[model samples]
Target chain A: MSQTVTKKLMLFFPKCECEKPIIYHLVKDHNLIVNIYRAKVTPEEEGYLVLDVTGTEQDIQRAMDFVRTFNVTINTTGKGVTWDEHRCTHCGQCLPRCPTKALHFADQATRQVVFDEAECIECLACIRVCPFNACASAF
Target chain B: MKTYEQINDRIESGKAVVLTADEIMDYVDKKGVAAAAQEVDVVTTATFGPMCSSGCFLNFGHSKPKIRMSEAWVEDVLVYAGIAAVDVYLGATQLRHGDPANMYYPGEFRYGGGHVIEDLVAGKTLQLFALSYGTDEYPRREIRTYFTIHDLNQAIMVNPRNCYQNYNVAVNDSDRTIYTYLGILEPGRKNATYCSAGQLSPLLNDPYYETIGVGTRVWLAGAQGHVYAEGTQHAGDCERTGNGVPMEGAGTLALTADMKQMRPEFVRGVSLRGYGVSLALGVGVPIPILNEEVLQRTCVRDRDILAPVVDYSVDYPQKTGRVIRYANYEELRSGEIEIEGKKVAVGSLSSYCKALEIANRLADEIRRGEFLVSRPIAPLPRHAKMKPLVIREK
Candidate 1:
């Protein structure tokens, strides 16, 4: 019997000019191999995108790195972790410190930080440096 | 209404009040004046999963033993007590309703979810309080106890002689140390026969443990047992690897088709939530108070358990501009450490290490009479809330 393999990746974007298309782009670019899923985004709250990327690790990483070029905030799940946005000031203090550049400053009007889930290595360097105490990880 | 000052006076004067669950209900029904009160700490135990050596072998891994907490009160009280290293058990109903990210156990699909508070409260244990300490600055110190479901139930159902002696040893040992053994549930007992006596019989009945005879065994082999065995065996292989290894090796490996079928049972079914408490007492205090101090101290007397023994060349950053290293836990414990080539006063080590230190500090604080057992008599708001909730709510 054939088995279906799937991987769910959750991406949180503080701000995004283009919304639904981003999901479409990821799927189309990845040849629909990945099942792109979106997380619920709240207003005034930072925008987050959860991508359920179903494909090979390399393919997933390729798609993830592709998303990183946009320079937004992102995070992956299932490694036992949770992030607190309340402590975040969106001062862009952690953007430079991110080794993978998984975080980007949002549009000034939006006061959001883009989280590139694909680029996040879960090293938690951003969490370590965030003075506002907004980041947390679990194992 | 009594002021905070009056409440503090009453508490200090030993005239402080403690209300049971029933009394609290009466007070609420009568619309009585909400006064400062405290909760009496109750300890209970809970059983966990199939007996396996998964969690005990390694310092960290997915297959390790776990317990989860589902109820809000238990989570709040456990957190308020500054305790970590607890296993939160989420039942199936809870997972479906709560959509909790951490519901990673199988039985969670049926029963209501809850958490395992080791050394605090055991299985099905509940404590309703009107007042209790809820502050990080001054955390409450209470005599919390925990037990497992198997032990608690066995104590209630099984006669003392019928139960195994190992149960006592296990419970006593867990009570004395940071570690607790979560009992396993085994299905398909062979040759077990139940017999009941008269109503006035002092002993209820005994389950005669035996094996089936040849004729019965032949019939059983053809029965559902074969299918059950095959399914269980397949599940076991999937949960473990093809070779029956618990976790995948740390590397890139492709999952075969057979492995895919078992993914949900392997990945999603085993939800293990750990709870930790920060005792104001020093890090090592609980060891002694728990009566494992002498053993642990003796064990580590000649050797350093927390010594930095990782291969520095391999573990250290290859492209290092400024590297900060500590000699041992002592240096980190002292709070002064060189970070990135500068003398920086460190409040604590990494979060992992900080949890250990905080737990120790809290334990010590309790020992020093600096902290008292206080619960929230009235539902406190965020500002009045003691410690920030660490675990996120879904």
Candidate 2:
């Protein structure tokens, strides 16, 4: 049986390659479900597209190859955490629980908690202790 | 000196000066307490934290050939139906029936009464299952139905205890990790968890309950409520600092509000791993600056409030009440604090920013004459101490 995986990818396009329809090729050609979290790309100017593409392991690889034919830059953002801002209450309960303090208050005045994926050691402590289930781990 | 009536009159005329407990700290520093008392009409204080002794009473309209529920549950979580034929009380900490609580793993505690209450307030529909022994007037033995808060005749949030004047800073002195309601405690005091709004706490602003008592109107979960009674275990005679603030948990308020009107954001359901479920409540109380002495009390700062550090793995379980050290919010919120010449990381269970937001929101209402400040009909009991339970052999 084939396994399915959801991977976040960052695609950078030159102004000339912006008309290539990369999103259309991802869904129609490879039969992938892409959730575009952020899109700065336009038809006239160079920008980036950050999305979570879900499909079988092989299909995602084929989509990457198809995207590379356009000479666009690609970077895998890792199977890290997808923080749902709506679910987070900013209570700061996940701070001391994280061994590396990956989830700390952005500042004292606002007290908005921000997650630094670089500091997260895949310990899964945030997923274990979060009362609101705001943080999700792919692994 | 000003009277509560005078302050209210000024509020209605759009001439009242309102400030949050957080905002008053700077004002007092710049203009002094006497000046603040003369300028400010009310000081709003708030706390958003877990209070286990919280629950709501709901009255379901009588059904056709009603079952008169003797046992009932809302979305698998049990509700106490002993009150009346159609009334039930859903406790915040009540866990769902047959939940795998530590039997398989260290318990996930996904769904519970608290979650149900939040869903109810959010206008989500839920399944209600009930059973009863049929009576002459009520003939049905079972009922399975879908309902929401709109289906109820009345829904009231009645919390026996809501705000803690001060609280413990939980740490682990043992060599192994442990799970508690305060959150996970790492071994050897590697990390700590403290739950309180510190200076913004309602009772902390009024420490002695001078103006806060039965019949005092308050802001509860984004709606208006009242301090109906003295909360359980309200230790009014606890140890205090030179400024009269309690050094430990003291002065609590029994609050009540219409659960239907409460906003879902303020009435959140929280689950602590290895511990059961609980509700995080938002409550705010307005203190009228009737005199300089009252105004001075509300001018507290985070650096001035203190909490005792205790070992959750041993002392707390054994009720030894051993205090490792005392740390204030200033040191705790610094992200790291030193104890015995070693640095220990700290986290807060209470939302400090949310408390400030609630205080400011209530202050806006007062300034706009939307929320009125009221005087207490009577003062809270003085020198009320909590007693320990004992086992008796007959």
Identify the candidate with maximal TM-score: 2
User: Per model, how much of the real contact set is kept?
Assistant: 0.00, 0.69
TM-score evaluated only on chain B, model 1: 0.19
For model 2, how does the per-residue alpha-carbon lDDT over B78-147 read when each residue is reduced to its tens digit? 9999978978999999999999887865687887888888898998999989999999998999999999
List the candidate 1 regions with Cα displacement exceeding 4 Å: A1-8, A16-20, A54-62, A74-139, B1-394
Model 1, A9-109: lDDT tens per residue? 65655555335456666677854365433355655555655445566666566777877776655565453234555434343435534667567544422
What level of docking quality does candidate 1 show?
incorrect
Q: What is the DockQ of candidate 2?
A: 0.50
Cα lDDT tens digits for candidate 1, B13-111: 555443321123334335422221122111000111111111100011111223221122332332221222222221211222333333343221121
Estimate candidate 2's alpha-carbon lDDT, on a 0 to 1 scale. 0.87
